[model samples]
Target: MQLIADSGSTKTDWRLIDSKGKISQVKTVGFNPYHQSSEDITERLQKELLPQITAEIETIHFYGAGCFTDLACQTVKDALKNIFPKSKAEVHNDLLAAARALCGHQPGIACIIGTGANSCLYDGNKIMDNIPPLGYIMGDEGSATWLGKQLLNSYFKRWMPKELRPKFEKRFSPSVGDALENVYRQPQANRYLAQFSRFAFHYLKHPWVAKLVYDGFNAFFDKNIVQYTDYQQQPIHFTGGVAFYYANLLRQVANDRGVRVQNILESPIAGLTLFHQGE
Candidate 1:
């Protein structure tokens, strides 16, 4: 059997595929070599993942958020070796996973727009170019945190539509003082700020929300997508919660820019499953 894992900051999705193509699944806390130590991953593997599996895994494909560099990938590889010493393990960056899942063997532009945003130019079998998504604080335009940050700003500044302000106030009684403390001093500030963007779905028709999301999409396209000389010709594919949820707006933005929109997946797990099965 082979194990396939797609990990992010929030959680990990594990799939065990047998020779007959039967697949079993499990979940665990996310692992990041950039943030967690080998020991941390080892401990979590022992406590959370070991007991859940019945198949003897022969190969492991791990795609994670922080496995960009050789050292970081080695950190995760070391932990996996410690846990499943006999099982061959491979570590890769999540961007590759997104590309393989979204574009498959076709050359295209693959993007991720969840808590953060990232995009890469996929040349059929590999990433040819990438625009760094320097997290929520620096960049990550068109991401949930990006959208939410603007919503919070407009709400606090009294720029939110007058009709929706009271409803927003009643739905979430946010305080400016608490918001400042959370954003400046708390951990996972990106996640905290991202929560507010969900309100846009409920109020999609509202001019204020529509404009905010439109502008966010435009910013993302302008900064990340258009940087590539051939971007206008390549079909763009997205895999993330924010992109899936705001698919209409995303498509509309693409239409306005004259770019082709191919696929928008809620998460890459399903597509990854298909990819590994084919392999």
Candidate 2:
């Protein structure tokens, strides 16, 4: 049996596969060494994950947000090792997962636009270069968090149309004070902000909303994708909730930029599953 996991800031998708290709899946809260302690991860695994295992696993492949460095990867590896003591475990950054899932032994530019965003140049089997994502605070231009921040800024500044303000207020009912508290004093501020990006999908017909989406994606292309040497030649692939939901807007931006989009997957787990099976 083999275990595979794709984790982001919001959730983790776990898949268990046996030799016959039968599969079982489970979901758990996201874990990142950058945020949670090793003990917290251990407790969550024991409580949320242990009982789901019906067979002995031989190997575990974990690709996750914040597993960007060896130290971060080791933190997760150690936790998984404690839980599945007998299994061989490997940990990798989520960017590699997106690369393998999107490129599949072909060269391409793979991007992730979720709670946060990242992009890398993949050459069949390895990442050749990457522009730093810098998370939601510093960059993450096309991400849900970035879009949400835009929405909040517009709403707070009374920049949105008078008609839309009432609807936005009614849907979220977040007062300026409440919003400040959540962003400044709370944990998972990125996730909190990202929740609002859904509004763009619901109210996409509004010109302001459409423009905001275009601007955000344009910034991503200008800042990250355009930096690559052969960005125009390579196929651009995207994976994550943001990319999947707003694909039409993304494509519009890509067309305006004269770049072609190859694929947009909501999550990389399915492709990762196929990749592991082939191995």
Candidate 3:
């Protein structure tokens, strides 16, 4: 049996696929090496997550946040190896997996616009280049985190009209202190910021929310994507929660860049299936 996991800041989607192509999917708490403690991660896996398919896994591929460095990947690999003694485990950064899911063996630009954002150029079976996803601080434009920040700022500064701001505040309170504290004091600041993004998701067409989405997407294109001048005209593909949830804004941004965008997959599972089946 083969196991594939796609992880982001908010959650991980686990899939177990047998040689006959039978598949099962489960949802687990997110595992970001940058945010989660080793013990917390271990507990989550051993207790709540791995038990779902530990009995069936023979080989595993984990694509997740904070597995970018060799050290980080090794840590996760070692942990999984301990859990599934009979299984071979491989860990990789989530961005590479997005590229794999979107580009497969073809040359194209792959981007993930979700809680965070990243982009890369895949050159027919390999990632030829990547635009640095500098996280939320220095970058991650066109992402949930960025949009959430905008929403909070707007509400706090009274830029939003009282009619909506009151409702927004009642739901999330738009407090900078609470927002800053939650992100800094917890293990998953990215996740915290992402939670705030749900407002835009529910109200993307709202004038205020639409502006945030547009600005955020435009910033993402401006920072990491526009640098790929060589593949500017190539077909671009996207995958992730935000891309799936907000297809219109994503498409608009792609059009603005003069690039043809194709296939906005909601989940990586379909692409993962296609990849394994050689489709």
Q: In model 1, how large is the Cα lDDT of residue 242? A: 86
lDDT of 1 at 173: 91
Model 2 C-alpha lDDT per residue in residues 25-94, reported as the tens digit of each score = 9999889989877778888998899988879889999999889888888989889988999999999999
Residue 118 of model 2, lDDT score: 93
- Compose the digit string of candidate 1's lDDT tens values, residues 115-222: 899999999899999988888999999888998898889889988888988887888798999899999998889989999888887898987788888888899999
Q: What is the lDDT of candidate 1?
A: 0.91
Query: What is candidate 3's TM-score against the reference?
Result: 0.87
Candidates in order, TM-scores: namely 0.96, 0.95, 0.87
lDDT of 3 by residue, 1-279 (tens): 887888876688887787777777888887877766556677778876766764567778898888988878877777777678788888988777887788777888889887788889888676788988888877888788887777777777888766678778778866678877977786657777777788887776678788788878778777877788666667788887788888888788778878778989887766865665532
Name the better of 1 and 3 by lDDT.
Answer: 1
Candidate 3 weakest ten by summed lDDT = 270-279
Candidate 2, TM-score vs. the true structure? 0.95
